[model samples]
Target chain A: MQIRKFHVYLTLVMFSTGFLMASSIELTQSTKKSRENENELQQEMSLNERIIAEREKNRSLEIQSLDRQRDISKIEEELAKHETDAAGLLANLEEARMLAGTVPAEGAGIVVTLRDNPSSNSQNVIQNIVHEQDIWRVVNELYAAGAEGVSVNDQRLVTSSSIRCVGPTVIVNGVKSAAPFVIKAVGDPDTLEAALHLPGGVVDVFDGFIKIESGKKENIQLPAFLGDAKVGKSVS
Target chain B: MGQNRKITFILTTISAIIGVMLAVQLQSNLHPLQSESRSITELRKVLLQEQEKSKVLLADISKQEQLLSQYQESLDSVDSIGVMKEELSRAQKQAGLASVSGKGIIIQIEQDPILNEQWDAENLPLPDPSNLVLDVDLRWLTNELLANGAQVLSINNNRLLSNSSIRNVGEKIQVDTKTIRMPYEIKALGNPDTLISSMKLEGLEEFFRSVNMKVTIEERENLVIPAFNGTKHIQHMKPIKAKGDS
Candidate 1:
């Protein structure tokens, strides 16, 4: 029995040592590779830190702009309150601004999200990625179904709005955004949802390609158009 | 037996050392990105994104400041209503609710006879003259014109509004919810030279030529795009109550 116990203990020690040696070899190679790339790693890390800092600063600036916008709205409300004749004018102006997408909007609507196919392979990259045409198709369906307001990735659709393809990303209202484009529409949620699922509509067209999803939301808030809305001064 | 014990003791100690080393290696692997970062290109992408956002945010700040001062001036001035009218007109123009005229280009896309795509080796059903210039094509055309400085646009007399959509419904193409049949006339109120040059650069003219689309881009001395006559409402989108919140 003592001899048997000794054999088992020796085997256990040998097995563990063998496993450890294999792992150590693997680890050493990777560690060496990492050491070789240490300089690049350091540079990348610093770059990441700077990006984070820049983003934080932008968030604060965004808030500043939003605050000022709110203040202007409040003053407009005061004016509309005092001047009865101007009430109609202010109301018309607000409607026009809403249609122009110059102001923030929120109400009963639907959100259509298109993301790159999860099973994307290199061979089918074109089919797997979301294109500007796909976005336009969805937007077209929404408007056809009587959507009153629409925005893509928070870039509100305006008269001068154009979705331009720039490499892999699309520029909506002159602001570039990538795939997984969230399209928010303000209208009858049921009508908007039904329009997309029509026979050979956006759903069928994007079938083996992008992942499209449409859902009704009680309230979908879209921001104001941030791009310059001023036309060419030469236009008379 | 004593020899066996000594050998076993040595093995045990060696294994213990190996076990410690393995743990250290595993720990390091677990914290692989403890230094943290993706690729260099990814880092640059993030940096450029922040820069673009910063640019937009800064522009928004100045715009808001300007609007605030204007509102302040109007509120204090006796001609407050007049100033409000100016603001209203500005919004109206931006919304394409007012007529605009300028030196621009007019594009006419008419159908021509063409067999089909060479890529369709099986001779699939025709993407013939009827479906040659779909709404997607029109959208790209519109994008090109607008990107190259087209201020006001109308497709088949249907003003392209902020909420406009070009769509093909049952073989009929519609712009801004109104059916616009083929032989489309797209009018743009902007610099004609810029629009035409950009169209050529996009190879749009060439592509249309190769297909069943007979396209023409002409420089008009004065192109007028009328106000959007379609229903404009704000039923669903209520301007979020800005008050009662910071």
Candidate 2:
């Protein structure tokens, strides 16, 4: 009976060993196949990852390009605006220069001449003489009549010009002048003549004492002023 | 039996770990961006930065538009403004806003020295006003100069403008409200030869001789006339706007 029992135990041991070896071999083969499959899956996963990374990179670059384009347009618009501003500034500067009398004036105008009565036999010379008030009256009237430019003896009359007398002679623009005053004005000759010849006008006032003659011409040129372009000074 | 049980336990643990890893790999494969939360956070940051940049750019554009509008206002009516400026400047120069200098003639007037000496000392030649240089006489000369193409004139350093007046205020000659003395000097800027010839043509020299007044003429190549020093106060002038205009 002990021998039979020992034989049975040996059989059981062999059977268990055989079954374990077969299963182990099968498990090894399956593991080897699974390893190959895992490798293929890992490769596919890596490729997908690379594709996703590349797509994300492309999208980011597109967004950056759009932002840059917008910035370029904004800058271009600003540049255009600056160019316009520059043009305006230039225009203003040119205007200022002209107004300051730093440039010459040219146009059509009239010349009015005044002379003392040659036949004045009056014992009182004052009555026969042309007074500063007379010229002033005529000049004021010319301006009133819309004279664009007026000069007495080529001295460009500006807003602050003064006509005065010192003793026997009349001083204008700081120079001495004698009889036969010539007043050149740049304007419509007809308008200036009409303005002077208006009822009870400058001509009427000086009718007896002075001989007044005025006529229009085609071309009149006035020179640039030679005085200091002093700041803070202007004629009303 | 104990050894078999231990082996069984080890195999089961290994299988469980492999299954869990496979599940995680599959999940990652399905959704990459979501599975990697870091990528989502990075993209969100980039988007926010881009949006902020665009916002700043938009603000800049708006600011530029405002500036452009201001510039446009000045640009409007540029041509008319240019013409107006030219006209105004011409008027200003004629009004004596600037000093003028040019080649011209100077006429000097004074009492006749020889005639005064020849006059009887006992009679003292009753200070005849006709013989004396009067304000009216100066005014006549000024008017004559203006008529003869004098652009600017000055009497004894006084600049002549449109409103300057020569008057006799008692014994003193008042020019532009200022009193002046003898040997009056009149400066004029023009063509010197024409001015001299014009005065001669008017017989001014003979006229001066008849009145016992001495006149001397000198032509200068370069003369400077000063600007008007008086103030012009306008009390009743105002601009008129056109209809339907701003």
Candidate 3:
């Protein structure tokens, strides 16, 4: 009976050890798959620290920018109050500011959003990606249809604005933005909407490659060109 | 007794492996993401936002500096009117209201000789014209020019303003509503050598040649980019006053 009891205990030990071995094997397999991710997580922590520091720097610079902007505008307002051509020039200057996209604006317009085909089964990936040409097409169409003001991802398209593609990101007004580009143009909402919807229009041409949808908004707010609109001397 | 001892040894080894696995699993749990569930994608999104904020704020600081210096110059001048007029003209030029003439480069893109030959030979059923002057190509070219410091740009006399757009509309290319045909002449006012070198460096001409388009780049001393005659009236966009007192 003692020998039998010893056998029972040995069997129990073997059975439990086998179970533990099976479960641990599965656990280690998953952990092996996640080891690369562990390294990434550590890198992500460092990235977090750097971003926090950058944001703090930006906050202070923003305050300094606001102060300088207030001072310049104050002088401009004072000068506009003076005699004759000054007021007219100020009015023209305001109009130019609108043209230069130096001031924020809001009006009835249409918002067109373009994004990558989420389920694109196309063999050519490059064709499906949103190229700068794709953006130029839509913006051109909007302007042709009489869009008074246009902004791509809220980066106002100034004379000097260059839209280029770098890797998977598109840079607008020198700011990097990923997909789901939002283009807002201040114009007759009906006209802009119809222009994009015309047969073989921008939406149709970009059918398989990009997914485009537009809506008319009563109050489409657009920010000013945050980038420098500082122009050098125009040689006569 | 020997058989029992060998079994016991095997069981101990197996348990030892299990212990190591358990310790490793515990270690992984202890070293989870800071938020416990944040994915790499979410972290990247936050990073991109922070980077954009920095870029915008940096540009803002520089622009404000330009404006402040202009204000000081206006205050220092004996003739504030002259200073305001100078500012107005500069704004006008940027708005494409004032005509600009200077040293720059002209890029012309048109149909290849083979394409016209094929069109004539193929008759009504043209073989899927591929290399015709595409608006996208023009946009790319003009963007390249602009990137190379081309201050003023125009397509076929249609001066590109701050809001100007070049687009392919119904088989024709339009520069802000002005339809331009084949032999697209793009005029850019800037440094001639810089523009020419950039065009060459981009291998735009070679790329166009391979794609069945004729490319001509010329450096001209007296290229005149006319003022934008198109009415860009500030109809919809109401300028938000910088100062509330105004």
Candidate 4:
């Protein structure tokens, strides 16, 4: 009985030790696996952070490139404007030079002065005065005679002006220019005179109502253009 | 007692084995779902990239369209200028003047007519203001002259063009926003004979006569019409060509 009891105690001790050894081996394996999982998680976290950073960098780069493109477009627009202005200026300069040489230094065509020829019986000639449209006709004829340029009283003609009757006075380029209207043109002396002498021409219509006179002069001087020409937008 | 203990031990062991099986099954099931989630995330990223690319392409297309419009406008302007230059050159040659550079004619129209001597003071007829000359008549004259080959027209030193307006407002006439009063001096650059003859045509001469206004036509060998007196607003139209497009 004593031997049996001792043997049982030895067997229990060996079994317990074996169990402890097996548990230790399992714990070590679990610890190693846990460590490996931790390493893998760290690597994944680092890669994710790098990807996020790269995306942000790319987004910023895109924004910067768009801004640069916009700036370039603005610069190009400004450059185009400058070029157009430069071209306009050059054209104007060339026109001025050409006009300087082409315009006759001296010679006068027919000068037609239109005014309200006072009625011999009426004291108030201003009351029954001339309207603006009649003046436009005479001016038109002078121009048709190849007049290079013209002015109403002191106001010179430009590229964008009109003559119309406002109340009793004739408005010229928005200014009130009164008569005796003196219209001056410079062209072929003989041809200009004949053009005005046409049977139904403006001069013929003047007849007895207004005084129309034509005479050749030794020299006629026309003023140079004083204002700028309006250049509109280019329409294709 | 021994049987009960053995049964309890067997039950505990069976529970442990079942828990291990459950854990393994749960892990396996979760793996595919996680992979699917990752795939969704990657798809979203790709979609975002594609959206950004499309936006850039749209901007490029807009830029190209603008450039094309601008180019077309420039070409049109050049063509118009060329035509004007050619007409001017031809007109100059016809005038027998040097390089077609010389003065034009000046026509003056008186808007008021003198009282008829045949009418007595007691029977004096009042004239209607509208019956007097108008700016339209001048415009007609200008058009006629241009049709007859006048290169340029100016009313009271204001150069008249195709786009010019001669409108009357509340007894006032505005030309390019400027109000002009008569008598108006119409200046034109062309062959004096042709222009005068064109103005003498039926509608024009009769129109003046019907109004009883006095028209004085005089041709000057040299006439200098003035430039327009107003501001020109800038306009930006479309381009005719795309950037870097052949």
Query: What TM-score does each model's chain B reach against the true chain B?
Result: 0.68, 0.58, 0.61, 0.52
Q: Is candidate 3 or candidate 4 better by DockQ?
A: 3
Candidate 4 Cα misplacement greater than 4 A, ranges: A1-236, B1-101, B112-124, B236-246
What does candidate 4's lDDT look like per residue over B1-246, in tens digits?
A: 665555556556655665665566556545532222243355455456545544553554454455444533555545434433443343223222222234457778665445343333547675678776665665657655654556666677665532345656567665645677877777777678877887786356567766655677888776655444454321111111222211
| DockQ (CA atoms), all models | 0.46, 0.02, 0.38, 0.02
What lDDT tens digits, residue by residue, belong to model 2 across residues A1-236? 54565456556655655665576567556655754565654555565565566556544543443344344334333433656643544344333333333334556767888787857655666766676676677876776565655677666665335566555556665556777778887667788789888888777766766788888887666543444422222333
Poorest stretch of ten by lDDT in candidate 3 chain B: B237-246
Better of 2 and 4 by TM-score: 2
CA deviation > 4 Å runs, candidate 1: A1-46, A116-129, A164-171, A174-179, A204-210, A234-236, B1-25, B34-42, B75-78, B101-104, B111-132, B147-151, B169-171, B189-194, B220-224, B242-246
Q: lDDT per residue, candidate 3, B196-237, as tens digits?
A: 888889999887876667788888988788888877777787
Greater lDDT among 1 and 2 belongs to: 1
lDDT of 2 by residue, B180-228 (tens): 8988888888789999999999887788777766889999987777776
Per-residue alpha-carbon lDDT of candidate 3 for residues A67-116, written as tens digits (9 for 90 to 100): 66567657777777766567787778778877877667778999999888
lDDT of 3 at B43: 69
TM-score of each: 0.76, 0.37, 0.69, 0.32
Candidate 3 CA-lDDT value: 0.77
C-alpha lDDT of residue B169 in model 4 = 56
Cα displacement (angstroms), candidate 4, residue A100, comes to 22
